[model samples]
Target: MTRKIWVFDTTLRDGEQVPGAKLNLYEKLEVAQQLKKLQVDIIEAGFPASSAGDFDAVKEIATKVGNTSDLMITALARAVKSDIDAVYNSVKYAEKPLIHIVLGTSDIHVEKKFGKSKSQILNIGVEAVKYAKTLLPDVQYSTEDASRSEFEYLWATIEAVVKAGATMINVPDTVGFAEPEEFGERIFKLNDRLKNLNDKVLLSVHCHNDLGMATANTLAAIKNGADKVECTINGIGERAGNAALEEVVMAINTRSSIYNVHTNIKTKEIMNTSRLVSSLMGLDVQVNKAITGENAFAHSSGIHQDGLLKSRDAYEIISPVEVGLDDMELVLTARSGRHAVKNALEKLGFHQITNSQFEGIFEAFLELADAKKEVYNHDLYVIVENYYAKQDVHNENMTYYSDHFYELMDLQVISNINFPSASVKMKRGDQILKSSAVGSGPIDALYSAITEISELDIKLIEYNISSVSRGKEALGKVKIQVEYRGEKYIAKATETDIMKASALAYINAINSIVVDQLLPVE
Candidate 1:
């Protein structure tokens, strides 16, 4: 029988520790829902004792998702009674609540970070586990930097925690300092020496990517004896990152013949889950990342292309469809032919194209091919989607006056060595409004001008800009969140010019505010 490996997702706890990668309450809820869809066995929500906001997030997740799903919901806590209490309070409503208590056990961490000796660390770990068991039956204990701890001491600590009622023992390569072979050996030795280890408790591994070997080390541990893998989506976490949930799951799936292990993850949801995490976290996966990157299924070279065309097994190990890629992307470049473009469009859900539409799209594709080194699926989708959106707007007569809307008329800005000033004209309903204001920067001045004309007291909370396509003249997309009368609204707009995109995005947000007011109160 194949061993069942549990996936413990710490995207909300460890993954959020990445500097400046904070997710608000709603964002956390969204990620939790996706994690459920990913079918992770455990979701470590957050450290409830850290902040009221974190506490609320954990509580809400525990109530909303935990009660509804079969998966266990957990929260992290230091090996302190107060922290354990907070964890219990936050997740008491969960269907299967777990409190993960950790302590520093390595010589450096115990001596320098906590000024506690090995005996003190063991005592703390035992006390915390015993206390946590009083509140929740399922308790997990981790000796921080377990990879660097002395072997005998680590074993003693584990033995103590298990005796204190810890159901799971996590060995973290806290600083990502372990090689694959060494890490595997450690887990194997622990499994060998620990009395009734597998029967009494599950052995888990949480490896970081500081040495860029998180996935390798994790696989090695699983090969040896680990029954659980703690990881974050897209490998996001402190410093380098934790093992990526996607990489590990896909690794086990692709090489199941060798590993002979299976996880509970819904493999088809992998790509969508990866995208959601990246979007909410504002982090981009590297192009060459193992499974969920942009170029993961992209074919470039002619020889490789020929082999792929003949048989995917010639060069590809994992089918794109297996990881929810749906279709493999053979990039459309100058070297690509009509067959490739036709196949690409068909895969993009643009089948049944008329001769005229095909001709137009092909012409546009040729132009894009000349301009860009490679035309991506997104570029193709944008081209096709924009064409349809424009056609719909024309056919439906979807003018701004049809609703509570604002349209940008004209914008002018002057930015010299001094403070920047902007002038703007906008059409609101049947009225034309104009205003001028000076600000610290051109974008700031433009927003100030718009605010003055609209006369709505709104605070800009967040603004992000990115290019929709590749090139000097690529379309710029702007997304902004604004607070109006204690309510928040998000709006997005795209334009060839970035400044225009910014202005349009702000106006769109203001329009949403107006529309919200007209809606009947629930």
Candidate 2:
């Protein structure tokens, strides 16, 4: 039997630290459920010591999602007893709770960040592990900026923490400073050096993408002796971001023979999980990012197209199907009936549809099919989600997909040689708000109209337009980035009308700023 790799996902904790990537309590729960479905071995829920809101959110996830799954849920804390206490209080409800502790041991970190001596820093790290062990058997210890720490000091710190009862030791390329081979050899030597302590101590790696080698470095560490990998969905984190979970998992699975390791990740949930994170977090994954990027499986060049048509292996190593993407050229037109929609949903792996649910899905599908010449798989997912939002079903889908604080009730835009203008009708709870504005273009006009209604100080940062698939009938997608009070927010929408998509996308982003931004902590 091949050795198992523990997939530790920190999308909620570290990934949520990104400015304006906040997920409300409900959104966090939704993400936790999805991660559970993704079959990650561990979930770092949050840094409970940071804020009262974080503490409550972590406790809620442990009590709700953690109780149902075999997932080992945890929260991060500093070496201080207060921080550890907050973590313990939040994670105590989990069946398998873990406490993650971190203290920088590098000369620069010790001197500059902590203003402490090397011995003092080492003592802090060890004490944290010791105290965390008393609370939970599953304790993880990370050396902040481990790549930059002195090798001897780092090794000594690791041995001390392991002796202090840390079941997992994470060596983080905190600033993404380590090159792949160097990082790999570091893990190898450390694992070799710590062998005498006990075989139960698991070595782990957490590599950031500052140098664009996070995935490479993580894979290299796994190739050496690391037993666990820490990552986030869509590679979202501070600065350049952390290693992407999809990329690391696919790399290991594709070259399993090279590493001779296996992970419990449900390979099929990769695409959906990536999309869910991207949508809720409002951070679009770069189109060219590896694994879950929009262009990961796309072939555009003539030579590449010919090669792909001749033999899929010529240019592709991972099929779209393996990652929950349906590449089948299936299309549904306005004439397609209920039976056809049902079959299409089944083909897309969406099963267990009740009669009422099918009725709703089919109705939404017909509406979309009428707007476009043909509706594809991506369109179906959106249709079903939109239907979920409209329904009063009181189910998970309804709660997860419902409007934030604003919903687009109606929109109209006109762009002519004279000028561009737009009108918007939206709802905020029981209020019907209508506004209109003129801009240089249709999207600008829509955003201007929305800004007028929102009456919020927002600066437009970036606007991107994409398609669900190729061809003229493809669904138009618009993703907009805006800044309010120095925090960045992004939102996207898809529709047959680019103008409508633009309107809804901007409205969605503003809604996030209103709802998530104004949410009272605690």
Candidate 3:
């Protein structure tokens, strides 16, 4: 029989530790609702003792979501009475409330950070669990940086915590410094040596992504003996971040033959949850990121597209719809052949085309592909629509070109050793708006000026620039992703001047947002 793997999501606590990724009370509540929808076994709402705001958030989540969701609500605390009491106060209203207490057990942490000996650390952990058990029935104890600690001492600490009434013990790869084999061996050895305690209590693993091996290390632990995984949404956390909850859950779901384990995650909610987290945090998921990225299910290669068109399983291991995505995307590129082009055109509702028209469109597609990295559905629609529009004009029919809702008129930037300033002129319909602002850098000033002129409260989630062709005067392509009113919009532009490309890209993204708002819902 396969083992049941519990998912404990710490997005509100550990994930929030990422710099500049703080969530306010309403945002916290929003994320907690999504986590509930995701069906995680436990939600580590926040560190209540950290601040009054966190305490209120935790309390609110516990009362609003946790009590009704039938899932456990937990909060982080150090191995201290005050911290444990704070957590207790925050989560006490939940139907199932848990107190999670952590202590540093590694030699470096013990001697340097805590200035305590091994025995002292062990005593504190045991006492903290015992005290926590008095307040909550479910108590979880974590030994910080357990991967680097002495094995024997770590086993002794686990035994002590379990004996002191800790129902769960989390052995974390705190610094993400352990390899999979070694981490697996550590868990296997602990379970082998402490059979009585291991059989009675749950063994959990929390891994960081500093080494980009958190998911691998976590899989090793689960394969060995771990019963729970401590993770965060989109892997957002301190340093490089924690192991991603979606990745781990999907890994187990997709590779059940190997791991022989399953999770309680509602797989269909994965993408929605990821988007919600990314939007609220003002972070952009990388295009090539696994599982929930923009390009995760996008096929661009000719051979891959051919195989996918024949059968989805020929190229995709998991269906996009399984993760809440609408469908797979066959992105048209220079690498795409005639069949791929026809397929894309059909998807864009351009099914009928003469051979000559097909040749012309394919030629134009090649030119566009040479200029851009990838051609989107919108670009293909524009190409086909323009072709028919030209035909209509040749037949002496009237045609109207759609005007841009927002257009950039002029931009002037001044940068020096002191303060940098920028001025921008924008045209919206019959109105010409002008604004100027000062910033720490030229791009910042320019963006500030644009925002001031447009009056759109947007957050720049991602900015990337690359050369379309290699030369001294290479055509620079700028891609910008921005978030407005909880929605993400991406736009790209190319120009000889990098700054010009950047300004155009920013304004184009703003225009795309406006267009989306103006579009009629189907």
Candidate 4:
């Protein structure tokens, strides 16, 4: 029998507690929609009372994104009336609104924190849930530290909240202490010992990642009959984090026979959600983190790759494509075969290179293959470019040009503007002035002198450099774009050194301008 699990996403509520990981309102809404598509049953959008921004985000998500039949939007609140009011206000427009009211339940929290007796805390939990029910029919109640609370006290409190109108009860392993067996036993006992256990409300588990056992504990909870699992994208939260939605879902999927569980998650959107969160949070997911990591499905070594090529199941328990990961890479190392090289080139977006071009590029590749013992994409790009560059500009249409070299006071001197490559030197009557100079850097010096000599004042807008050939002996290519007399010119060149690269680049820019028949302002 396939069991069903409800996914509760708390990315906005708890994930925001991560320092410097706050998402703006628009970003929050974007993620919330993604979660809805992921088919999360409930989304704890935010702690509405925390800030005006948080309040607005919760309200907006609740109003704009949530749908009634398939999804529910929720706002978190402390047991305080003001917090409850804020939460209620935020979710008022939600088609399926849920108010989550949480209060301290452990002995330590009751004494030092709220300074209330156990009975008083119970009363507060009941009253809070009751008040939340008045605002919204669906209310979720959480005992802040249920895992650490005494079992008898926790059971009595759970009974009180359910009686007081909490539609769901969230039991959290606050400190992430319980191991799988013990936690499963605890939940199993809760159902066995507690009265009206299944009749009153749904039972959910919220596990943390403090001991690196959140996913395990959550599974244990489900093994013992937890109806919902609370999690976040990438497992991001206050401490080590919550159970990753991807990990738990895939686990249940892979071991469905044992857990007998299924969730509404699309499974494919796991990668997209992981990437969006990583991008917004500016936190790089480790290459081997888990299901969505870059190298999660990567296999290296001759034996493994060969086995994978033959049949993925030979070495892989899960297909990379199933989780949106690209298939195995046949990187060109010293030990790589010809088939590997062909495969690599194909994967490089060059599926249809001419045989002549491939032959020329391959010869250089063999030379590079002898040195580094591995061929990267950059090395291949350079090899291909060298085969394509035209040497002489005599027959071709030419436009703009300039020169640069270093000068005193860290200034740049540019000179020797030319076009058509055939018109080398210019004459001013019998004066016959030649353009040349030196500057700080070769380009700077060349540009400064060129400015003095060209009689065409130009302001450089952009410049770029790259290698056009393979190995250290490869030629450097420079591209310069400049604005002269309200006209833009682009220059490019292949050269041995950067100084030559700069000269050619400027010349290329001037060539573009001249080719276009552009003239400087008078």
lDDT of 2 by residue, 1-522 (tens): 998999999999989989999988888989998999899999999999889989999999999888855698998998899999999999999888889888887888999999989999889888888888888888889999999989999999999889889999999999999999999999999988876677888899999999899999999999899999999999999899999999999988899889899999998999879888888888888988888886788654445554555577888898889888876222367766565567666654557668998898888877876675555454565576677667754454232323336678998999886789989999865789999988888778888988988899999877877777777778888878789998777666788788888887777677667655533354
lDDT of candidate 4 at residue 82, scale 0 to 100: 96
lDDT of 4 by residue, 221-246 (tens): 99998888999888888888888889
In lDDT terms, how accurate is model 1? 0.85
lDDT (Cα, 0-100) at 158 in candidate 3:
91
Highest TM-score scorer: 3
Candidate 2 accuracy as TM-score = 0.68
- Steric clashes per prediction: 0, 0, 0, 42
- Which candidate do you rate higher for TM-score, 2 or 4? 4
**Judged by lDDT, which candidate is best?**
3
RMSD for each of the candidates: 9.3, 14.3, 5.9, 12.3
Worst 10 residues of 2 by lDDT: 395-404
Q: What tens-digit string does per-residue lDDT give for candidate 3 at 25-128?
A: 99999999999999999999999999999999999999998886469999999999999999999999999999999998789999999998889889988889
Q: Which stretches of candidate 3 lie over 4 Å from their true place?
A: 372-522
Error of 3 at 514 (Å): 14
**What is the alpha-carbon lDDT of model 3 when measured against the actual structure?**
0.86
Ten contiguous residues minimizing lDDT sum, candidate 1: 395-404
The lowest-lDDT stretch of 10 consecutive residues in candidate 4 is 399-408
TM-score for all models, in order of appearance: 0.72, 0.68, 0.79, 0.69
The residue ranges of model 1 lying beyond 4 angstroms of the native Cα positions read 195-198, 335-370, 375-522
* Model 1: per-residue Cα lDDT over 229-257, one tens digit each: 99999999999999999999999988999
